[model samples]
Target: MPRSALISALLLASLSLSLNARAETDPWANYDKVLKTLPKDAAATLDRGVSCNHFSGEINGDNSAADKQTFREMKKLKCGTVDQDIASVKNKYKNNKAVVNAIQVYYEN
Candidate 1:
């Protein structure tokens, strides 16, 4: 391969390796970031509400961390997931960017 192509390939490989290592160390890091800066009021509400979720909003924490693929994992987790387009969600978290796609609370009695 040409020198330029070899450099590009190495860079790509290193980046992929770094990402894989990060994920393995903290499988729930993305979720943590999305939930990290929740305002006291909303966080409290979530803890108290019968059903709660952060259905839709952009995440500005770490671009590489929040991704479309994460949605699949979100669903598989022991947490409720909801459609991102719900009006209640939109209105509730209109300006918040740290919101995850969805995370409905399933309180166990």
Candidate 2:
């Protein structure tokens, strides 16, 4: 390959790696910072969702319009996307009522 083509390929590879890394990061991972912005009930619900499994399953699907909007709002609040944020929260709280509480908190807040 020509030197210019090699440089271009390298640049593309670098950009792809960076984007993938960023995408892998949970958007709602920073909820702790925004926890203060949430109401007592909302905060509690989030805590609950962090502990539950059922709600977390629903969250994984794209059907929750309210949840989607909540995810969008979370981004503005620096909370990131809900789908990304819920993965670990689900794992951490799987089977716990906290999942329901968290989803409620996410939508209500």
**Clash list (residue pairs), candidate 1:** none
- lDDT by residue (15-79, candidate 1, tens digit) is 99999999876535554454446665444444333223332233333534564444444454322
Q: Give the alpha-carbon lDDT of every model.
A: 0.47, 0.56
TM-score of 2: 0.31
The candidate scoring highest on lDDT is: 2
Stretches of candidate 2 exceeding 4 Å from the true structure: 28-109
How many residue pairs in model 1 have overlapping backbones? 0
Query: How well does each candidate superpose onto the true structure, as a TM-score?
Result: 0.28, 0.31
Which tens-of-lDDT digit does each residue in 2-98 have in candidate 2?
A: 9999999999999999988886664455556555555565455465444333344446455479678655544454443444455555456666564
Cα RMSD for candidate 1? 14.2
Going through the candidates in the order shown, the clash numbers are: 0, 11
